[model samples]
Target: MSTAVKHDDFQLPVMSGYAKESYDLCKAHKLSFQRCAKCKTFRQPPRPLCNKCHSFETEWAPVKGTGKLYAWTIPMNPIGKAWVSYMPYVAAIVELDEGPRMATWVTDVPHDQLKLNMPVKVWYDDLTSEVTVAKFKPA
Candidate 1:
């Protein structure tokens, strides 16, 4: 069998491990991450150093919650039938203003009409009792 992304479980990709700091920032109401103090370039999936310049110095900065639709797809069959309650959903790659791309669901709009390169802004969906994930919609 091909090792392609055939399962629904593979659809929802989030920053884990090295990127935990990214998730933490959203929870704190401050979008932050280690930007190479030397290069001043923003780093995603936060790390002790930079990906381009390999500089170890970094800090947190605010992000504007706005981005463009980098790429996306609509899942015909969402995770579970129950998820169909929130059916006709859209999964997208939103390139945040900070230059890092994040995966999210596009809400408050019809699924079929989702457009490419459309402008969008972040909105948190607090489905979990503890944490809220970022979703996007037309700006």
Candidate 2:
């Protein structure tokens, strides 16, 4: 994976334990999420336990990187100065083929053209040398 192409002064996502792991995998161009080792359930916003089976054991599982656009929104104002250039970006909820819904951004399509249940695939945007964020694009 390559570092994200820098545009302006956009701030990168903060890295924590599981989030660091996720970002590291994305740096390698892999799209992974936390999965319960016992019951095999996938989850995002990676946590310490499985919500479904209440299991403590978990693993980082790579996903197919394909999914459907469940929903989306285009905020009228940018959050801050760094995001000013990219105002009105499409933020979306994508339901992965494996059943987990992730919060991501929809790219490569105009906001007006976005549709519910539209096919999409995971794409990486390297925000810095050490961070890569996962986004979705029309498949």
Candidate 3:
């Protein structure tokens, strides 16, 4: 048996390991990705080894915080209780100028006005005392 939390209780990702490092950077308002030192390729969802060169050496490199909206969707149905209030929000895939694409929220614009390949910029939301999420907005 389980109990449900309030709808206002937002669910956040668990910050640990490689993911924690990424969020830590975002907490500082710096949108960065794990870049392979050998090949200079940037990657999202920070990982231990490079998929291209299998290199273990990586650096947290900041991006220009600009990207294009590759795709998006408005979820009319909440995925969870925490998202009930955020229904109809834009869930988007942003392709960064640096080559890697990230899943993020695109806010501050009407749902009907969103266009494919529209310019977007990164923004940080301080969700909690220790967590900050990186989102996007029209640029």
Candidate 4:
């Protein structure tokens, strides 16, 4: 089962193996994704094999960390007490320059200023000593 850690009342993903590697790289402020070494396909939410070529040959590849805001939504209601503090947060889907879409929170921009296809870049937030969540903001 996937593990989660509680931080400021929020349950965050636990770092292990691929996830660990991703977070470790994020701690160093690097953005990356798993790339199929055989077919040169970049994938997120890292897996052991390529979905397209069905090959186990893969490697963590760094990305340019630039993307366009594909979509977004503001939660009108909090899911739980843990989310109360972030009630007005914006959840967004960013279509990366490499063509992968990442689900992340867009910050540093007002909700009224958000626009479709706006240029954005990845930013890391160290939620804990061992975990850093990727966020996005206007570029």
Best by TM-score: 3
* Candidate 3 ranges beyond 4 A from true positions: 1-8
Q: Which residue segments of model 2 deviate by more than 4 Å? A: 1-8
Residue 19 of model 4, lDDT score: 81
Q: How would you encode candidate 2's per-residue C-alpha lDDT over 1-139 as one tens digit per residue?
A: 1123466466666777888888899889898888999999886778888899999898989889999999888876877776656666787899999888888888888777899999999889877778877888899
Give a tens-digit lDDT track for model 1, residues 1-139.
Answer: 1011223433242647645566666666565555778888887656787888988888776678888888887766866754554545677888887787777777766656668888898776544333446777889
RMSD of candidate 3 to true structure, Å: 5.3
lDDT of 4 by residue, 33-111 (tens): 8889999887677888898999999887888999999999988697778776666778889988988788888888878
Candidate 1: stretches off by over 4 Å: 1-18, 80-82
lDDT, candidate 1, equals 0.67
Clashing pairs in 1: none
Single out the weakest 10-residue window by summed lDDT for candidate 2.
1-10
- What lDDT does candidate 1 reach at residue 11? 29
- C-alpha displacement of 1 in model 3, angstroms? 36
User: Relative to the true structure, how large is the alpha-carbon lDDT of every model?
Assistant: 0.67, 0.82, 0.82, 0.80
Q: Distance (Å) between predicted and true CA of 112, model 2?
A: 1.9
Candidate 1 weakest ten by summed lDDT: 1-10
